[model samples]
Target: MTRRPRNSAPEPPAHFAAADLPVRDCVELAAGLASYARRYGLAHVEVSGPPELGELIEEFGLDEVHFVDSHRRPAVDIEATPRTWRCGQRGLRCLSDQLIDAAHAPPGRVATASTLAEGTVLRFTRHNRLGDALGIVTGLEHYCRDNAVASVAVTGSPALAEVVEVFACERVRYAPLSDRAVSGDAIFARSSWSLPWLDRFHHSVSDTYGGRVRHCVTPLLLRQEPERPEREDVVYCQFDARSGTALPLRSARRLLSQVAAHGDVHVLGGPDTQYYLGHDVTYVRAELPEMVARLLSCRLFIGCDSGLGHLAGCLAVPGLIVSTDDFETTWSFFRNYASLSVIPLAAAELLLS
Candidate 1:
């Protein structure tokens, strides 16, 4: 058997920016980006709102120097003539126009819009990992090597910065915001210009549940405290598994039994074996906040990488994040949360130590 090499050649850096959207979106985006920018220092940002939005930007030592007024174009104005997808609402039609216009704009300005009948003139590359994201950064670096971007402002995660550094991006910047900013009432009215872009981005992305429970609940969990535990002896466990992985039932049960030796262990989310952890271990399907609260009340959070782990960071709860693979990526995203101690699945036997 052949072993794979660790970290090949570094890739180029990408341009990161944060836009001023609804407070909720802005804060979430900021928290994710701040970690990246702080680590890599990629700066060159374009914000869509006023300077006050800088509060979040400064948290990560990132500066927001440029601002674009929000544009509120009607959805019908941007509708596709042939109509690739059905336009259920008039608002969507208006958004179609904005995307078309943005995509057609000249270079220097970032445009995210639907491809028109003329086809997409803008070059696009998919980045699903650090390498891929770095590839995109490399292309951008070659394009603007001499005239380096003032900086890269990220509103995502630090893992994104590692990709940027691979591209040799030295001027990285970040924006950080607390969970309150994400759930607080809108600080500023929706800008007239923002209306059109928001609609177009929403439509182009095809995000169905803009106002649904998943989106609303995750952010809420970041802000609110979990409900008080019903029973002191009931230990809540949040088993967060990454996209492609599983926890062995026997091993997990053994681990749970050890952790909650004196308490009833309750497992929530991901996998059915949680149901078979014996009479002392119960399972429940609750919303993100409820799940988070339950986990907080419990003695420990034992699972693989997942949104639940990320949520634990936001709650500042002491827990363990299990990652049998991709330890670097997982650590990059959750390190800033300050409450998580990541352990690879191979090291489970040493969990208590």
Candidate 2:
């Protein structure tokens, strides 16, 4: 349900306080945020989320919502469009570490790393994956606000744009993921890889709402696959280094083999992934929808803490997330899932059991 915004003056935007509001379901969360903003007695609640979230805010009468279209990495000229930029992959020598630290840094300390030239803007675009780009955007949002930099410009795919638009950026530009060379001054690209967005989103659904978001919006976002008699005892699995570093081949095989002992297990991976995994286990290659279908029909899912792992949890499928060394706290907060730093045969056996 949408929370209609008050006709009165808006409340000052507080990302942290809004994050603490207890609500789920994108629409409800948006309304609650609007209410929170109003309670604070400020005008114009600054909000962001996945791009599609703009509609929800509009439905609630938050017309001036800062819908930041991040996700796209199209080639654009920042000189002419001074207010817009990208979050895609860009190599920054000395500024990368400082920028990442700044996303979580307090308002007072974020301006210490000012690599951008005067009158230039920072844009976020592609890192290795869309998730990576978003993580950088979260940090950049905080940094820009703290540094008194105007809104950031982000460009990418429509789907990515939908997600990024909900983020706290000033403006957004949409374009396909491209290899086009980005050239401009004061343009810092998203380089560091981490999914900080999950944490930021989670806090918004805390308090009164249940901590797990798997219930509020997962069903709407993903269609439930009908049960298959033939797939009754199968376990769906995914293991690849598509976004982050790959889990070791031997570790994955050992875990999968143990899981297979419980019953039939189906492995999911891309073309290159299948080679290292070998043919001993049943391998199924499919696009995202098919992959979702497989997970829905399976007894359980096992995979690294990548995009698929997040999806499995959101779908409320019982699963295990293999956490790598650089595991972020955000990745562990999911419904119906357990995480292990290393592959544990016992964990697999328990999940399948």
Q: What TM-score does each of the candidates earn?
A: 0.36, 0.43
Top-lDDT structure, candidate number = 2
Model 2 C-alpha lDDT per residue in residues 169-226, reported as the tens digit of each score: 4432334434442321112111111212333322222211222222212111322344
List candidate 2 segments past 4 Å from native.
1-125, 128-197, 200-220, 223-231, 241-243, 326-353
Give candidate 1's error at residue 348 in angstroms: 3.0
- The Cα local distance difference test for each model comes to 0.39, 0.43
TM-score of 1: 0.36
- Candidate 2 lDDT at 143 equals 41
lDDT of 2 at 132: 35
